[model samples]
Target: MSTTEEPTQGTTISVTEQAAEEAIALLEGESMDTDIAGLRLYVQQGGCAGLSYGMRFDNEPEEDDTIFEHHGLRVFVDPASMNYIEGSVLDYEGGLQGEGFHVENPNVVSECGCGESFRT
Candidate 1:
C-alpha cells in the first residue's frame, strides 16, 4: 500500500469525530433491542479495484483484532486488513450531494470510478 502521510505510530486506523458519532448513533439504535458492543472495520479482497472496505456492528472483537475507542465509540480492525488500512482516517460527511462514512486512506494508490473500491 502507498501512503502519503506517515503511518500511525502504534495503531492501525484513526477514527474521526463525525464517524465516531455516526457509529454510536447506529449502535444505540440497535442497542434498544440487543446489547451492542462496537463497529468492525476491515478490508476484503474484491471490488473492481481489487480491495473493498467493510464495516459492521459487532458485539465483540476477535482474538487478533485491534480495537480503538474514539469519542465514546469502539472500532475493531482485524490484523490482516490492518496492513492495508493503516493510517486511514474514518470520517462522516453530509451535504447536498450525499452523506455517509468515508475512509481517507493514505495507502490508496488508485480507486475505482464507482468509488467503492481501491488499489494500493
Candidate 2:
C-alpha cells in the first residue's frame, strides 16, 4: 500500500488498493468529478440500528482529521469516528441482490435489515 504524510497531522488513515480502485471506478461514472481528492468516512447516530456510517468524496481535510493514501487513493477519517472504524475494511460488492460499498466493521455488534445502519 502507498502512504502519504499529512502536512500537519500525526495519525495515518489507511485504505486498501482494492477499495481505492473500486471507489475510483464508481466515481468515474457519476456526475461528480473523478478527481476525488479523497473519501471521508464517518459515523453518526440516529439510524434504526443506533448508528450509521456516512461517506462522501472530500477535496479538503478537517483540522482534526488524519489523511492517508493507498493504491493511489486518499482516505480521510474524522477524529470522532476513527476509533470505531479502525481496523475495518471498506469494500465494494455487487450481485443480483444489489451493489454498493460495504464496511466490514469489527466494532459493529449488530446491523439492521435495511443494511443502512448498525450498532456496536
Candidate 3:
C-alpha cells in the first residue's frame, strides 16, 4: 500500500506462505505484471450459507480497495467484502485428493456442509 518499505504486519488481511506461493504462481502464469497485478478476494450473497467467497486476478487495485502485501504477494479487498472477512486468512491445501485456496475466517459462525459457503 505504500511506496516506501513494505510493512510486515500492517496488512489487514493475511495469507499463508503456501497460499501466497500458489497464488503468485497463478498470477505469473496469467502473464500479468506482478508489480501491478494482484488477486482480489471478495464476498458475495449466494450459496447455501448466505454468503460465498469469490476471487479473481486483477490488473491493478481499485481506487477504494485496501491492498494487502504479504509473503511477496498482493491481495486486494474491497470495503464491502472487508466487512465480512476482515481478519480472514488465506491458505492453500494441496494433495492427491484436491487442491485449492481456503479462507480461514474467524468471524464465521456456521458453514455449509460442502464448505462452499458460510455465515458470519
Highest lDDT model number: 3
Write down the lDDT that model 2 would get: 0.72
lDDT of 1 by residue, 44-85 (tens): 989999999999888877766777777877777887899898
Over 4 Å off, model 2: 1-14, 26-36
TM-score of model number 1: 0.86
Point out the higher-scoring one by TM-score: 1 or 3. Answer: 3
Pairs of residues at least 3 apart in sequence or in different chains that clash in candidate 2: none
TM per candidate: 0.86, 0.77, 0.90
Candidates 2 and 3 compared by TM-score, better number: 3
Q: Candidate 1, after superposition: displacement of residue 68 in Å?
A: 0.9
Q: How close is candidate 2 to the true structure, as a TM-score?
A: 0.77
Q: Candidate 1 clash total?
A: 0
Poorest stretch of ten by lDDT in candidate 2: 1-10
Error of 1 at 113 (Å): 0.9
Cα lDDT computed for each candidate against the true fold: 0.81, 0.72, 0.87
Among all windows of ten consecutive residues in candidate 3, which has the lowest summed lDDT?
A: 1-10
RMSD of each: 5.6, 4.4, 2.7
